[model samples]
Target chain A: AQTVTQSQPEMSVQEAETVTLSCTYDTSESNYYLFWYKQPPSRQMILVIRQEAYKQQNATENRFSVNFQKAAKSFSLKISDSQLGDTAMYFCAFSASGTYKYIFGTGTRLKVLA
Target chain B: DTAVSQTPKYLVTQMGNDKSIKCEQNLGHDTMYWYKQDSKKFLKIMFSYNNKELIINETVPNRFSPKSPDKAHLNLHINSLELGDSAVYFCASSPRGGANVLTFGAGSRLTVL
Candidate 1:
């Protein structure tokens, strides 16, 4: 069984600043994928970024990027130049390749203050 | 167009009642999943279906049933709803054979009284 952990329950960052939400996972599977998702008050969850465990280079999507340290079992999401729209519940998820289940962390509530 | 859609965005019901939430995905993905997000925002997988075949059924109660009529549709039915059943239910789909990128629907918030 794989477990994802998000140590921070809540986080706040000033507008236009950067914020990093930490995530760690315990998985015995060697082939897996990590993801970050954002759910706003509207309740629509959207994918932020994803990183493949086999890829040493972290994944970056516009302002959202991931610092994936496979050896350390850490995959943190970094939001650069955060905006008000970035305020949402961020979840870190893990899925083993060829498996149908996704293990999610107890999301972090992020607030972007203006 | 919505990639993944679930009906009854908000469901309010009484205890001991039975309710069902329908989900459909237009992404033509091979796998669909049901997840429950509790009040504390902890998300956990409840069930998964691949091409209408039951794959992953987590440690959910027997009162919660999932039906997949096809590869693109998965419906969740709950019997004897309880206060603990009040939570946000999310439906997601992914191309199972490819990169496991899941696209989720706008969750269905179920409130039991």
Candidate 2:
């Protein structure tokens, strides 16, 4: 019954610049987890960052961070100082607390141009 | 050492053929999942196993079957493969009480000719 949406099909950013990929989800659960995963050319899905709905503070992992607006039901990823290696397909995912299932959004193909 | 590994990284076969993709996780987690990434880059959960017990089974075709012999192994078997079955299948695992931080394996790309 939960769904995630990534409106941007593709995105591009120049090296050393910043780009933000938008994501929105619909869930009735009050406690949940949100994640951002990156799949490189090798097709290995790597966890980028994660945020808990109960945590008011957003999550940050080095150059990658999330702007989680719980009330707005929006979780966007911002990649700062982007590098060519950051080019990959990024996915937004949601999982309810105490559940093993995850609902993923349609990926956003990101290209970090040098 | 690979945390999660799936065999047959690339499987190309003719339609109506049967194939199996093996998955093993060394993380000792209680939960494992099979996700399908279609050509449109959409990832959907197909099945999940917790300690060799079926947990989540999506509305996938009956041709797709999943077997979990143990907590660390989950294998997927597809019968009468169709052209639409051509997609990347990913195996992932995560700790039961954790935040659902999935550690995924290198996907197995299935191409049906």
Lowest-scoring 10 consecutive residues by lDDT in candidate 1 chain A? Answer: A95-104
In model 2, pairs of residues that clash are none
On lDDT, the candidate that comes out on top is 2
Best by DockQ: 2
| lDDT per residue as tens, model 2, A1-114 | 899999999999999999999999999999999999999998999999999999999999999999999999999999999999999999999999988779899989999998
Stretches of model 1 off by over 4 angstroms after superposition? none
Backbone clash pairs in model 2 (N, Cα, C under 3 Å; residues 3+ apart or in different chains), count: 0
i-RMS values of the candidates, in order?
Answer: 1.7, 1.6
lDDT of every model, 2 decimals: 0.93, 0.95
Where does the lowest 10-residue lDDT sum fall in candidate 2 chain B? B93-102
The CA lDDT at A94 in model 1 is 91
Q: Write the per-residue lDDT of candidate 1 for residues A1-114, one digit (tens) a residue.
A: 789999999999999999999999999999998999999999898989988899999999999989999999999999999999999999998988888888889999999999
- lDDT by residue (tens digit), candidate 2, B21-64: 99999998999999999998889999998899998999999999
RMSD to the hidden true structure, all candidates: 1.0, 1.0
